[model samples]
Target chain A: MDGVMNPTTNIISFDLTTTSLRDVNHYLHHQVSPGNHIDIHHPNGAHNLAVGLQEAIAVDIHGHTGYYAAGMNQLASVTIHGNAGAGVAENMMSGRVHVKGFASVSAGASAQGGLLVIDGDAGLRCGISLKGGDIVVGGSVGSFSAFMAQAGHMVICGDAGDALGDSLYEAVLYVRGNIKSLGADAQIEPMTEDDQAIVANLLEQAGFSHNPNDFQRVASARQLYHWNADAKQDY
Target chain B: MCGIVGLLIKNPALRDSLGALTVPMLIGMAERGPDSAGLAVFTQPIAESDRKYSLYSGTTVVDWGQLIQALHQQLGGTAQIHTQGNHGILTANLSPAVVKPWIHEHYPAVHILSTGRTIDLYKDEGQPAAVAERYGFSQLKGTHVVAHTRMATESAVTPAHAHPFTAGEDFCLVHNGSLSNPHSIRRMLEPRGIHFDTDNDTEAACRYLEWRMQEGDDLKSALQKGFEELDGFFTFLMGTQDTLALVRDAFACKPAIVAETDDYVAIASEFRSLAHLPDIDHATLYEPAPEEMYVWTVS
Candidate 1:
């Protein structure tokens, strides 16, 4: 395998089971360049696999990843063929981070920029404090996701965690699943024409194969900001 | 991770006198970006001729206290120097260029991130509260201000790494997102003489805006170009001498909400941050569209 491998070439392949997690990160950090494409096979729960990279390289992790799999990534297209663990893509700044299987807690937490795609269920705080980025969860997301997102979009295909988009400001939350309840200051609103288009496009991008018309939009009620003595009494 | 708070008002009553609210606004969101904080305030543009004889020459950092002392001596009264973190703003009668050279000579490592007639910067490492207390930000008075709290991820945690980063004379940016193409973009911009202080993606965003604005594009147009050219997920809030703008990527991966009323426009990571504001009743709160921009100018 060593004799056949080439480091400088644009196209790279990784047999995940045979490769060390450290090697993967090192290769991604120092080997691959921008606009490069890579493919992976037989990845089985590699931990801290790809963190803090700044390139346009593409990697397909064939199976699940362990904790903090793609934390703080700058630019790179990572497609996990299976599930991911806690803090997947945490604080990612730019590029695309994709997970084909379920994800653990804090997916995309405090992420400044980038796209995080969870094709299956995601645990807590998906897109939390997301400064700017798009998070497309094809399935459910755990509670307290997007708690204080300053700006960005979060789209869930399945059920959502408790307090979805609580106290949200500047960021938009779109979900197609059943919501147990809205978090503080969150309220359901009519989807505008422009919003519908956005939902449709996002749905297509996430490969959801669902109707955008069926999804309901939720946003901040804007009531907390105006709380007065009278409003306090109602609360 | 970093928390950034910025305010810009178009009302004539709010300009140049915004330091009072600016300090609190930054302190309020101190938890989001708690590593360092800074503030810059700008008055109306000054004539270029008048700047030539000023005490500070070029854009450089000065011994803020000593400079303030000299200005006070020259002006013959107590000059107000408002410090927040490593950055500070002094309202006094002095030339920025003359002060620039002195700062460069004495505090060579102290980067004068940016300089203009109206805008001055102060920043330092530590939590927002610490920086604020050390710099005496509570007493600052200005029409509009921007501050940041930082949790280092892709870059080092230092005073120089703080937010409200200036790209040019009057353009500054606070960002929440990573630029996936920083290496390529950096290579493209560096050869053109654009300097970078940190490896954070926001720096790329700053340089991107600077490059765009330098090509004769207005802030809005430059931001639009950012939306079109820049890649990855980002919700960028940028400020100029007179305008504030917000941008989301094509995918809208980040979170941002804007609540507007007849009297005020409040934006934050969470609705609760703006909860204290009166007159928020039934406000129209909505998120900025992905790949779209919302801009406010103080003209």
Candidate 2:
């Protein structure tokens, strides 16, 4: 991509209106160094923008992005100034993806490891099937979020919709606001000092000012871990 | 996957550009739905005594003048028709009870797309962009509009199966997800004298909701019943005379986003369709919650 150089900050700016996404992605995938800072202008809800980045460069997308915007993200720090579409950081390996506006369904779905911070609300099934990822939402999450999550942490600073953490496996959820309901095998347990410390660290990383003591922890009850023939099929 | 787009103009000054603003949104979802496309536009209602029917001739050329003349003769009603290609909107001071069966008998080849005091619909089997250009969607002016582009997962890829499905006056619904029990729903409605237009899944939902309204349930309660009875994954956007309502299934598997400003409210299956909207940068953008009825009416 023929990006213009910002002589002062040494930031490279790629205008999507002129440069194709393939060229930009090719450059990001193959040519970026560890310390590079890139600016993408005019995203306009395009899908698969700047995905599969393996370097530690910083990326700032100026507008909204479509599905899988930062999917499979690596060491790069990517931020969208506007909203994000479904599957924003699906299967991310590492690094950070931050959305300044609300995100659509399945944000950070099945992400192995990374920090996905949404300053606004996230839709249904956020972090569904998560595998060792960390998600911090400044606003509420919709129904069936963190369903069957294996391992990770989700910190919700606001309210959560129905089925906060359903059928969870070793994933801890800290919510500072009310949860409409919990999923099967998920229960609200008494928060401990260790949980408070974890919440504090994640909140600090997400740049929030909420007190960790205000959060409640939701985890699996381990009842569904094995089969029970006497209880019929209903949960 | 299918594409659904709806726009309701609250500002009278912006109503004239409803179709102009929605064309890009329909085209934006071309990848999701490329088989067929259609739209229903709700303009100012005509005289209370008059009703209009959107008629499509479907690849067959018919003399619209002679049809209107014959309608005026047999029905003994002063009927006027406006034509664009094979599609026409016929207006008359006639009840749908008398006119619908008469057209069905005389012109069996014609398809009645919609009927209402203010609604006029057009649909065809083609690419969404081509279909939009073919019907002059850019020139349409209305208070609200509901449109769909089809990928044809549950039914045939015909123009009739394309969305903006209507069952009663001044109301239309477009769907993005398939229903699991459309056949069962059809069986439920057929005994009540409600006719089945096509076997498409969305038509079942359209007729069911309208049937609920016909039974004295308001839009919100009708939708509440719909959530209980309709078993499937659906993001339905509907348009009535003066209102636009949107809802997703309980699971919320499908995607929908709304961008609303003081001037207008726009709904689409994705934000890609809404990026080009006027003042979208400042519009309040949010996703509709699962199983919640979000209804907006023009003042």
Candidate 3:
């Protein structure tokens, strides 16, 4: 891929077919100031694209990415025009990672901060071990989503697979469609006005036209917060 | 971590390029599985009376033509050998009951990989690319292919332990995850007089599913029974003479992606392994859901 800078528009375009991933990642890490627009072409399911970005820039990828694309982002907004593999926006301190197509497993795992938006379905463990981040999926999320989540909010515009929000802590989940089954210590509570407002805001950010009122809240029952010997591990 | 790839050409004319397309998919998974590799191809069936046995010489060289001559002289039926590197496929009109023991008694070093009417399998302890080249995989023509690149999470990295494990006629299975209860499954099957070729956990799973099929269960029913019996993580891809099937375990920790077009249905452990497929940009791509059966057949 030809890695070149356009003098007129102030855009840096890197073609993966001609440019090595290391070179493009090197430029993304060491070069470019804030507000720069980067275009990556022909990703072809390559892994670890646009990771560790610490500036307020815009990066757009044109094709499918393998794994861990846009991981550990600080302030950059990255958009993948095609499907993304596992861990699309993991451990982001802050930023926006948008997938135009489906996302594989662990869409936003253990993120301290960021808004991860997926326009299509997400694979298993969508938000497993989440910590202080917001995830909005336009399509369904697979099983074991939000397992042991510590903080942040998740909004699902579609159905959820088995075991949604197992061992959740503080983090709230809003689903607009059916949840096949709930995990241990995870219950569906009534959606309040404040929760609706948060879902509305997250939906707007995610560019989805779904109504926030259709969502239901899923959170921790807090039963497993303390051990009781008589429970015998039954939920 | 291992990688499993399967391709079933929907168009009859594209079957010749089966191995040509599958080689890239296997090589793309090099990082996930580097220690060993195997491929099983379901070619056109010869006839009901004939059986094709895939034999490996295992780090040793032998006169393949002489082996076939010896089989003809001893068994006195139609026998032929197709030699490729250290592997030979012996097609005989005689039953395995007459052929297997004779080969064991005469050619003790030759190990059989699979026995079927339409299957020929090759496996070795080497890099995936090297194994593919060593077996001339690019020239293989078949209705479907089930291949594996193993990371050796269990069992030794030997030719026997390489995946695409076969159990019965025209059937093979490749796995990409570990089985927690393989010993239990083995013990369960062993009392039934089922013999195991390797201690590899995938072998147990392969044998279990094939055993279920042998016990009057259809492929889908056998797979459903497998879901109830096989524990731990897995993303299995299997191939029969005319079918290719894929299934992931509950929890679905191991990744799997399927790209289906009018021409082909490609299954891989990851999307990158399928990126180079024809018309892939426009193919319908989706991850196989957990505990779900996806089966495709040749038309």
Tens-digit per-residue lDDT, A53-89, candidate 2? 9999999999999999999999999999999999999
lDDT of 1 at A1: 33
Writing each residue's lDDT as its tens digit, candidate 3 over A158-183 gives: 99989899888889999999999999
True contacts kept of 1: 0.00
- Cα lDDT tens digits for candidate 3, B82-143: 88878999999989888888988999999989999989999998999999999999999988
Model 1 per-residue lDDT tens digits across residues A1-235: 3112456774577775577667777788887778877776644444687788889877777655656777888888888876676678988999889898777668998888888989878866778888888899988877788887878888888988678888888788888989877888888889999888888887777777888777888877776665467654643
Greater lDDT among 2 and 3 belongs to 2
Candidate 2 lDDT by residue in tens digits, B24-108: 9999988889999999999999999999999999988999999998998898978999999899999999999999999999999
Query: Per-residue error at A9 for model 1, in Å?
Result: 73
lDDT of the structure predicted as candidate 2: 0.94
Better of 1 and 3 by TM-score: 3
Q: What is the DockQ of each candidate?
A: 0.02, 0.80, 0.84
**Candidate 3 to truth, TM:** 0.98
Identify the candidate with maximal lDDT. 2
- Model 2 lDDT at residue B40: 96
Error of 1 at B8 (Å): 2.5
Question: What range of 10 consecutive residues in model 2 chain B has the weakest lDDT sum?
Answer: B69-78
Interface RMSD, model 1, angstroms: 15.0
